[model samples]
Target: MESIKASLPDVIQQRIEDLVNAQTTDEEMAAHIKELGCRIAALEALAPEEKGEEAGQLGEAVHRLCERIRRDYVAIAYRQGLVDGMRMDKLAAEE
Candidate 1:
């Protein structure tokens, strides 16, 4: 896991570190972490078990870390009106 962390993209690692260091309300943080855990678990459950065990493990870890950062920071930002929500309807209309 240490080696895996070392190999992650700098931007991703920095984001994770930022999340770990952030000072946010506990309720918000807990909700974000819970969302991240659910997302990671769903992804892991969908992954096939037979091929490239190491790759699967690495992918799962990355997914988990990314989810954590996104949930903690991105979600909070969206909720606080700092970041805009996804406009799926606009995207569909464009297509």
Candidate 2:
């Protein structure tokens, strides 16, 4: 995770840290995570396509990190949705 963080663009890294630390609502956090995933995917796509051992290794590293972050974001969104649904159901029951 540290290696992944180290490779991230500085602005992205800072934004991620801020989001994690802030007292944000679940919807906001989930939205930010999805946005981060999209930004990372765009960056990965825009990276210069090079052919070499070093380039191959770097590409693999970036790919792995991007996938990991995307998966994490999906998990967060799923959990948030589940919790929100449960809360709604409970509120409906009370009414």
lDDT of 2 by residue, 1-95 (tens): 44334434653555577568755567875786678666656655666665344555565676678668767877886786676566556655555
Residue 18 CA error for candidate 2 (Å)?
A: 19
lDDT over C-alpha atoms for residue 56 of model 2: 53
lDDT of 1 by residue, 1-95 (tens): 44334434653565577668767668876786777667656666676776456555766788677668767776665554422113333333445
Clashing pairs in 2: none
What TM-score does candidate 1 get on C-alpha atoms? 0.34
lDDT of model 2 at position 48: 68
Instruction: Give the Å shift of residue 8 in candidate 1.
Output: 42
Q: Can you list the residue pairs that collide in candidate 1?
A: none
lDDT for every model? 0.59, 0.62
Score residue 82 of candidate 1 by CA lDDT.
28
